[model samples]
Target: MSERVDLWNNGNLVQDIFLGEIKVPVKVLRNDSFQAWYLLQPRENGNKSSKTDDLGSLRLNICYTEDCVLPSEYYTSLRNLLLKSSDVQPISASAAYILSEVCRDKYDAVLPLVRLLLHHQKLVPFVAAVAELDLKDTQEANTIFRGNSLATRCVDEMMKIVGKHYLKVTLKPVIDEICESPKPCEIDPIKLKEGDNVEINMENLRYYVDKVFREIVRSSISCPTLMCDVFYSLRHLAAKRFPNDPHVQYSAVSSFVFLRFFAVAVVSPHTFHLRPHHPDAQTSRTLTLISKAIQTLGSWGSLNKTKLSSFKETFMCEFFKTFQEDTFTESVKKFLDDVSSTESKEPSGVSEPVHLKEGEMYKRAQGRTRIGKKNFKKRWFCLTSREFTYHKQQDKEPIFTIPIKNILAVEKLDESSFNKKNMFQVLHGEKPLYIQANNCVEASEWIEALCRVTRCNQKRLSFYHPSAFLNGNWLCCKATAESTEGCARCTADVPADTQIEIDGDRETERIYSLFTINRSKLQKLEEACGSIAVYQGPRKEPDDYSNFTIEDSVATFHTLQQIIDIVEKLNESHEKYQKKRSSSAKYGSEENPIVGKVS
Candidate 1:
């Protein structure tokens, strides 16, 4: 006889099938309330053969309905299992799918989980999984994943693990999205009145411009495409508004400096030197943007030459004055030359390279050189008239020194197999010492300066080689040698006029003196107008204010004003009390003549 087997869920019989078909797949009811599973068998009977002998059985490991509510403990256990087995391929995929679902609607809840994944360097897989899921909350999940701090950390970690190229492809879109969000550029209207309104506005503009450029720089380190977008945005803004407003002019000009600084920093972090080797494509792109920006500024300046000339001069002078002591002075000078009008000539007099006697320092700059075959390191180079010495950082004694007299020739090397473009080889009796500069211009400057100090002809330096200026078939004159009847570019054969001796050192000193005088007057004005706060404390004040001190100057002024108001109020109250006391004494005397007589 045929017998039936039944499966019960929470005391409700959900499924019935023939007992003989126990090996076949059984379909059970799908419901949240279904908790337990049971199997029934035919009761033992005295027949020829019974289809099933067992009377009852229990089934474990049954899957509940998809809508069934899971306990917190069950979820925790599942998550733990998933995390523990994350290294396994199938388990990892499953975990990612489940975690994505869990975090789909509740991002805040799963932040801890996300942090845990980031901590363990497992975020990429999870992010990849979430990216693949076609869920309604995918965009939200992506946003949560690319939240600023988290996204930065994730990108940093991915860069370390998967490298910059990989992260560039994977995370660049996210960075672009983050950078596309606009920041508030409002300035404090109150501060605008306390100082020169133009200066105040310029400062605010500079701060915002710096903020935007810094973000662009950070983003461009990996994905260079964003730089074009940032450049285009700035150029657009500057072009549209620069002609109408000085504030826009100031922003455009300041942004040009900012871009130049960033470009130099990217190519040469040690001294911000813009050498030929600094990723040509990127550097060229940045420099092109800067040139365009500067051209825009120059055009505006030219249009409003009479009105804006003072501002331009002051801006350039102040910028140079601020960074005069830094190695970037030369770079800034080059930028000024590029952007400034022809009428505004930089101090053109060539300064005699300072010659040192004994311990006197002629010049000092940061340089890098190879000590051995492959051990290249950066060092502090100090030049004296007698010798050029290099030292390790913070060392009292020099690691190496080359006598000025021993130097035969200083020649710039071409881009070679081992040496870079900004390298100069000093021939000191056949023991060639190769030194590198931050950029081609710096290298040329060093060579020229060294030539002058060593009593060598500066024009004879390798950089001044005629071939250096050749552009393929054309000379520096822009005429093709084949097309021209004769080499008219050969000016060396022509007798030149006598060289005019202009004291560049004296002119530079004069410029600096003027700058110092103007700076002092400005400082005095700032102090007088309460733009700069003066502390009359017991201790002596510092000549240069600390960053914190400068930031607190305005607040300190406001606080002093508050204190003065409070003191005046207290003084008025004290005067009133004194008047009341005197009146009371008079009244007491009038009331009692005996009391007055005792007094």
Candidate 2:
């Protein structure tokens, strides 16, 4: 595959001409990952190798994983084990934990695992379980989920899978505007060009930040229900994790949603497909400033820790000073609360859900744990904020009561599930409570009523089975498993919230990766220096490192050490992640599993 780039100065109105391309063999990347900087060789038609220096080198982090997955029948043992994760406490000992342990990176394992769990509607419980375990180890609430552990990665990937449309509705337009109407936001005097105005740049930076932050805070309704549910779980978990710290509730949600997700996407819009191409350098600087400000405000715990003194650059410090207004912080807190809110809201044009909604319906209970002959029975049903109950007759003792919180999803039941019309399913923790309304309108009303009351339920499902489980298999997909996920997605009032799929890439982390990729180049340079000193002749193999020098060697090395010691703490992190990566015992045996499974 080849990547091509062209540089034309649209702003300068100067005749610009620069083209570069690079290609690699298919064999090198087959069923594996390729990550490193490649020389941005000048366009040489179809040439694979060309020694060219005019165009700068580009860092390419690409992975191509092709798995020869056998048919579903062949993986029954493994699939069955994995689907039973909810039943496993601590979640660290479960099959899902082992699945991540075997992967080279959690990123690779998270997607398929989340997709599988979400498919089975088993993701919420596992998430809550793992997060609870993660909380136990969190000595400081601010540092919760700071590491790119499996639980965090699972939620991150889940958002990416479902929140793409969320990102579109929430931040894409603002991102598009910023990318198109380029602005010069470089305020540092050393880096500024002759005509650059620091004051104007600062104003533009503030404007962009205000716009983006405004859009985000106003987009509570657009947040996805799955994300909200996950956030709801996180907020409660964080509060319980640090009972004394009320701010942990806000921090836990914002740490991922804003600091990690939204800010990262704003900084690199191209990666999330919000923009067609990478922004110009000036525009990128504008975005980077905005992202920094947003992250600072989002850091509710860090607010107490750093007090906004985290900025090292004097200009950035000055820039953040402009946000001394309390509105920014309030806005951030409100947005986090809204995103993580589990308090059910009445859907528009629907008000009776809060007070009461009582009707007659046919009821049948279905679940994996059931062990009895079942039949549909006509019953009078009533729903309220506290509980959903059904009695043998109206105004009489209730036969059964389903706590409102227990309700996970209220979706249209597939006719194929029971061969009866006007039927719907109410899925909860214990079993599927099948209800049949009098007619289609009545069914719709009941379903809507149940959903409105349980809309903010922390464990509400993103999807559910449309068809009923019959005999030993699901009629919808013909899967033999009783605990299989629904074949259809559930309807929701919340729009998709956000999709900021950012890997943990701090400034030092990026520098460290670049240094690692080019460590061989540095070694080669040392050899070239040694050879020339001994041979006393002209350089034979010219090194390509001469062209890129944004900093001196001593300063660069000093920055690198800081990358390890200060910013990334690379040495300690590497040891933790690489510990027995090849051994399953590193995570622990299935009989004795470890929490926070590392890669």
Candidate 3:
């Protein structure tokens, strides 16, 4: 008889028993319907005694067929039999149920067995059972499977049972615990040392380095230095470890921590002014780490030749803006200026330094202009009663002033012409007021006469700048108030009622005329004729005051001549008038000779 392995229910009956021939290999198949094992003879035919020596006898596998339907009582009996086995055995009853359910494609039964294993503190076995068999409805079942309800649960239980913790902390908490634990087994750092003998116990070094590296890097922030060391360790320990495990490889690839730390320590501070002196220290440390990582990665002999290339590419790309904008360009300019000025270093033949315009560099206090440029002065002006005075750009305090003399003749330009050049050239083209004074005597008389006609300032004598001639020339004159012996025929066609400008450049000028035409008499004459129909015909022949129906050139001419006579009288006898005014209580005396003919 061969040795028999029997598993029984609490009812003292064999639920599943294994028996084979002592001399020959015997195959066994369990019949679920009978809850008994059936011996299926092996392929080799030999005497029973020789079966004991057959190597195939020890390699037995139990199989169940699809058509063999087991009673529910038999499944229950099998479960009780496994549970009744000795406690020292690591065999799982839940695993048995899970296996049977999987072979039968019973997902509903498998989920319950998963729950039973979760209850028995066998989380790894339960997870293994779930992983070993493909359940049609695994996702639906896992929704209800919370992890073990304790903080100190094993890594296997904590990872699966409380998947929420991993999701919440992003697995950082677990990685931190693995690193921070005092136990040597928690994280074996020796395997990650740079100079471990790799050929002897090669598997142990690779295994320990990979295992420690995996847990360390799952969350890098908790143990950044350790993360760097493990990667360096792997680089030295085995060529096989590079490239494929980038999660570990990238973390181990030296520069990873330096890049991340640089972003926070250097980049964040310079951009946001986040940290003080501490950030400076961190920056130095980061640069050192980065250099080491680059050197180490460059020395590697593996497919991750691209890893070294990619590290450089990624570092350059990630920090390009910071290095170029914030650090390299600005600092280089500062350093060049400092060295060139202080040390008196001669320029190299390679390249000359370029200068910057104002408001270019950030270092010289925000919103300020840079070192060198000329300061521009504001233009200044002053106004006088007779004229406007402005400093010429070439002249200093003593300004070259301009006076708006008598407005030659005020005239408005056509609206079309005014719109085209905006009246800027109007002053340069034609003088506004035009007039002539007899001598010094006639000039004073006419000045008063103009006050009556225009009703403007009584004493001021000036025209808007550049519009009137300071020298009182005929061509500069716009129109005439009275005739002057020197230039009597000078005449200009001036439009009426155009506005004049007087500011900074010009003073307000009091207008004085040598003659005044009575508006009422002119209106009466136009009314008698139906129209002052000058320029009525298609050819637009010239018309004069003589064309009126009244037909009194003498009356028209006399009216104008009387006004002129009054001005002349005043001009000729100003001293007499002045003397009489000094003597009289009233200005227009009854005996005043010039007053009687004027009215």
Candidate 4:
């Protein structure tokens, strides 16, 4: 029961008009799959007497067949079969391989397969095996792991799922800064604004590329250990496959990390939650220039100077020439070495500070016991990944230090509170620190920076008074009590840490369902395996197992027989379970809710 709204003006939700919604019972998803046009209805508890206009229906396709997973014992047979995938000789014949072959799309099969194997700590061997097979099919050393094979998709999915936090802590601050305080970095001659100098724009683009690149390389320690392990496997397997090429291993890791991970993040920062929304036209051009430069720099090892010629625009080629130094190449190599290491990639507990925002601003002192105009003093303010601090002067210290974790909320101050034009407040456990920026843009920039960094803080507020607490009361809400809850709800409360937990049993069950749907194709695959095993003459031009890759026929046939047996047994168990469910839940109730086309 939620409404989607437009995110604009520093992640603030504005013009949030009410829309229709659909309410489906939780139990309706228990062991049932449905596709229906659920009619839209008015908000149930919203103002009852209000005459709401009619909203249209919505087509929903639900895949939640199991609301809760069965106990561990129920999944034992399926679990054992998946765990022994590597041991099954000629990995192409294994259940995992069969799933990849029969499914129309590789991703549908790869998701469940990767989760199951990774969950049991048996992923590397299978990935290496598939990658080796993929390499044998390739003649050129340059094109390894470029195709969307099972091995490639598995690693791609793994990086995205595991590296959620890595992307956030590494790039979010820079992305926020770029979006908030935008400068003209558009270098194209046709696209330049009136005062946009080509050299200045190029320098700005380079500065951003350097900042993002530095953060990425130095933050390898934050890379998830699982990602490092998978990358290590890809690196070794690729080097083993192409023993002549000295740089194949770097390409193997960079193919996914830089080309897929960092480059894509830079191009579309909002998708990664680095930006609150898509950047304006000029900002987007800046990001595109930066992203293109990064992609080339990251590809330093494999392609060498060859990829520089791949740039389209004449200025782009010129702009990219700045990164030809050996230092940039070395940085890419070092980053690859760090990320693909087999050792523990854990953080050292001491957080390094990456600067987010800074400027001189007027701060009204938190005179909790007293209030006066003399407390307002100009101070040098600074923000970083760890803490926010301000000093008496640009070079002087001995002022204030507020940990970012304790920042409760930051909002604009009531203009009437201090008769100031560009004022805002930093709310924490103590009294609010009211500050006045030089202008509106700087004010919004500071607010956006603080809010983005502390978004994941557990103690962050859901609401805040948009005005100042002055003269013993909140000016905006006119609330006399200091602790009274805020009248205005807070915006920009997106969760800090993304949770992408994969249930092992549920994934195993999903694999089972995929197998059940393509059972006939599975039968054909088995027959093809048998034919390839027994036939010893001139093979047919269009062979039986041509659709599926059969590396070793006898081995594949043996594995397929075991798979068919397990699926049949599971099928019987499912039938018995279905009978029990239908008998017990004939009448729809809370235990087995029924959902259908609504009035």
Candidate 5:
């Protein structure tokens, strides 16, 4: 239940001339007309739209007509009184009060209401009062008055008009204080102190590290440049905390790589830095730390395979890319080679292949593996002619018979040609699988050939228009038929009954099937002329059968039957001659039978 009462602002109810000096209290009938008086009504507790309340009584009661004038004259006097109140009087104060009370809990409405009051010059003082009340509790502003565009605008406008003196002087000062705190800076490594200190903030380390890591994850930092700093940091932290513990060293390195990878590659791009770094004295200390981290990682055996595998999965590309440079590549190769050399004597399946140095190529020859693993050898390739060439170490001669599937796509190399120093990248959609190429052109050609041989075998794609094929474009698709050297029409032979209609201007020819009866004939013509390599000459038209149709009279007569009988006889004669020739080739020497065709 609710009620609304409209009260005019001017004077008291009893003594004012508007009501002609009426008494304070009086009762009136529930349904009285008021044509000659200033009618007043009391607030009630029921829906105004309802004719009667649940108790079967009218909700509102009015005073009857009396010796009274309208209240408009009193309202005019009230305005004059407001004008005389102060330099900035509270005119329309009642309306402003009602608006504030209604919107007290809904803070977003305060701005619009204040703006509305701004248009009315008499209500400035009332509006200023509301603003002062709001600014009294800063916490309330935070809780209820959200800082959106409108709120900001309202605050700015209020401050401009009312000045800071009318409100809390500390509000603007506190906001400035917040803006003064330093934001995170670019390229500044987090200041990590060595020992656990009494008063240092633990969250600052995490906050700054996370900020830096996010940049790394997003590739804001290049792998080559940041790997040293990131890996060195891990090693330093481990050495400082765990001293000589080998397990701790390995765990630290692995976790460090994962965190850096997530930050630099998986986080926001702009937050990271990928600027190039030349090998210089400035970053010597960081580079030394990275080498130590690698050495720590190398000390692990089978016990740490799980964590090491995760590290490998996440940063294998980063590792490989780092390994390609001169300073890091040799060290990585030596480490892997050392590992391989140690496992050679022991019966540990087959040793992992040593990562060879760039510019060096290894060809696999035929050989059987020592029995411990199911697959004696997993296949790999050597970079040759920009693309990779497969070689099984056991094979005497190279054979390009094995099929490689699941190719993601060919990657362009940075260098101009397939040489010793070109860059290449081929992602296989798997985390740890990639093929490097020497150059782009060879990659393109190789990938095209690979697709041709290894396209999905179960389904066939429909023929695509020749215009759709661009010189270097490639994609996976379902083909309906396989034809390597010719158009789809030549590959899928039409039957003898199908007719081919050729259409085009004088310079070109377009071929299409007209009827089933002439297809075989057209196919024979194509085969005889070698399919007109470019259809260079003017287009030729076949004899038109536009008006050819069997007449109904001829079809009902005996002459039609005679024509069909003769055609059947001629077909039988050809069949017999073919059989006789085949029998002669099978039984006698290579010779044709029924030379005269009498049989």
Candidate 6:
């Protein structure tokens, strides 16, 4: 009798008949075929009632015919399947072999797959597969690694594998890109000459270096080999770029120091799992690099000797002591504490208010503003009770001062067609000073503070003509808003109005009278009123001054009289209390003669 066996035909089960116990081999007619061969044995009980015990299945060679190549999409599908399986199941050797073959034979076809694997954080498996092949040692691999964005994505992985070789290949290119980019320093390189001021582009360089080091830090968390490689690469490149020029070298080192790489490492030791024995060599190597960087700074001539000396005396000395003890966290913390303490001890701005007069109060605010159409320059402005002075740097003399009393108005400006924001105009007589804040909120705060101290309310000044004093055009002259046209109606030509002058003087006197009260007397009167309020006890309600007429002189006079009465009552009570205390002391001494003996 013949029995039928099942076989997969186009992924569907189909039956094949065998005439005898001897098996017949089947031939695949298609160019590509999938074959699964298996052996079946009788059950242990030896019952041959059509059921058999299956041992295991074997995946036979699934080969494509000559002139037929596997579709590129098939490789992609296989790669994705392998990556998906890597999450839950270990990828079989057969699957890894297929991927390695694809990568080696059709490298371009598998590049996208490799990138996808890297992006999905399946780098370990991908690298394992690549390791099985000759890809790493190939010229094509290096070209692909260097030419594409994959370098950045897999920099850490590559570093773990290639170490300094990867850094050596990539560092120069990054530095070159940074050097060629638009820098914060506005130096024209073509016109630059010897002895001319050559700004180091510190900001742009810092940004570039920060990005590189951040990637290095992220990679170092998993691969400790990156720590030494990255630092060595940076130090080597810096030396190569600046050779014997300590000034440029100092700038490069300063930029790196500003990144606070060591501080970040110390603060996030857990992230890197940076233990002495865990990553034995890397731990010592990282500390050595940090120490070397700091020591290099001490030897730089570009840094201010006085400031550097102070830093050495404080941060460097403490850092080295703790660093030697392997207390990295404490070392960083102490260094930061010393830095903060030193900064806090200094004046808030570039310079102290060196010329502040007695009884005058001042506040320092730091901001940048355009001066006479040039680029915006940072300035430290000191606003006093009566004047505003600005300095270029700390310890420098004031470059300009404007009397706050002379300020006619301060108006917030709207963003124009350009994307400019947080701008305001300060008007003094007929001249306008345009200033800008970092943001709208900062501008609003400055406006509020200036109005309060200068006593020039924006609301009251809003009624004045918008262009009254713009570009030196005066309202008194009835000149055109454009100063170029000149004043057509000069006040000097007209006869003096005696009545107007008298009215102005009387108004000024009235305003001055509001501030003429002695502040010390007012303080005493306030204390007296507070005492009276306490002595009266909690009443049903207190008098509401909300409805009081602001312009009523009679009402003001009555309020002043009430305050005087309260002060007089408080003085009388104080005098009586003093007399009572003296009498009590005398009576106590007479009553207790033994107390005086003890004393």
What TM-scores do the predictions have? 0.19, 0.56, 0.15, 0.64, 0.15, 0.18
Return the lDDT, model 6, position 577.
58
For residues 1-599, write the lDDT of model 5, one tens digit per residue.
Answer: 22222332234422111111111233333235322233343223231322323222222334653211122332232233222322322221232232222232334334434333333333334433433333233242112222332222333343333322211221223222212342221122233235434123323323333333222222211122112222333334444454555444334334323322232221211122211111122122222233333333333332233434544333332232322334232332232322222111111122432221122222212222121233123344543212334445533344432212333323332232222232233323322122334455444444343332222211222232121111232111323222232133211111111212311111010000111123343233323233233333655675232112112222212222332333344345446666766776744344442343344
User: Once superposed on the true structure, which residue ranges of model 4 sit more than 4 Å away at CA?
Assistant: 3-69, 190-196, 302-307, 343-500, 594-599
What is the lDDT for 461 in model 6? 38
| Model 1 residue pairs with clashes | 275-439
- What are the per-residue Cα lDDT tens digits for candidate 1 across 370-461? 22334456766666545767667534588778776566556554444233457765655533466667776666656654543443211222
- The RMSD (Cα, Å) of candidate 3 is 51.6
Task: Write model 3 residue lDDT over 1-599, tens digit each, in one string.
Answer: 33333221222331222223223223333232323333433223232322423422333344543221122332332333323322212222222321331232333233333333333334333333332222212233211112221111222222232222212233233223322341222112232345544343233323333333233223221221112222333222222333343233222232222222222222233222222211222233332333333233222132232433444445333322222223222322232222112111112221332211111110111112222122112233332323323343323452423332332322222223112111111121222322222243433333322221221212222233322222233233443331222222211111111111222101000000101123343344334333333333444554443333233333333333333344344344545555655577454654333433454
Quote the lDDT for 184 in model 1: 27
lDDT of 4 at 55: 64
Query: How far is 558's C-alpha from truth in model 3 (Å)?
Result: 99
Number of the predicted model whose TM-score against the real structure is largest: 4
* Steric clash pairs (candidate 4): none
lDDT per residue (tens digit) for residues 294-315 in model 2: 8887777444324657668877
| Evaluation by TM-score, superior candidate among 3 and 6 | 6
Which sections of candidate 2 miss by over 4 Å?
A: 1-19, 22-65, 301-306, 345-599
List of clashing residue pairs for candidate 6: 350-394, 351-394
What would you estimate as the lDDT of candidate 4? 0.75
Candidate with the larger lDDT of 1 and 5: 1
**Model number with the top lDDT:** 4
Global fold similarity of model 2 (TM-score): 0.56
Candidate 2, residue 240: Cα displacement in angstroms equals: 1.0
**Per-residue lDDT for 1-599 in model 6, tens only?**
32224232222232222111212244442326656564643223232434343433334555643221122332343344445533321222222222322232333223433344433445444443332222223343112212222222233333333233323232334333433343442123443346544335323333543444443322221112222223333333444444564343233222322233333333223223332111112232233334343333323232333434455334333333322322322332222222222111111221333233211112212222222333345666666545766667655777777775566555554444113477655655544555667767666655554543343212223223322332334433555454343322211110121001222222222212221223343333334444444455665665432222122333333344443344344345445655665666655563222333444
Q: Rank the candidates by TM-score, best first.
A: 4, 2, 1, 6, 5, 3
lDDT of 4 by residue, 286-350 (tens): 78788887787887463346766877787888787777787778878877876786432222222
- Model 5, runs deviating above 4 Å: 1-243, 260-439, 443-599
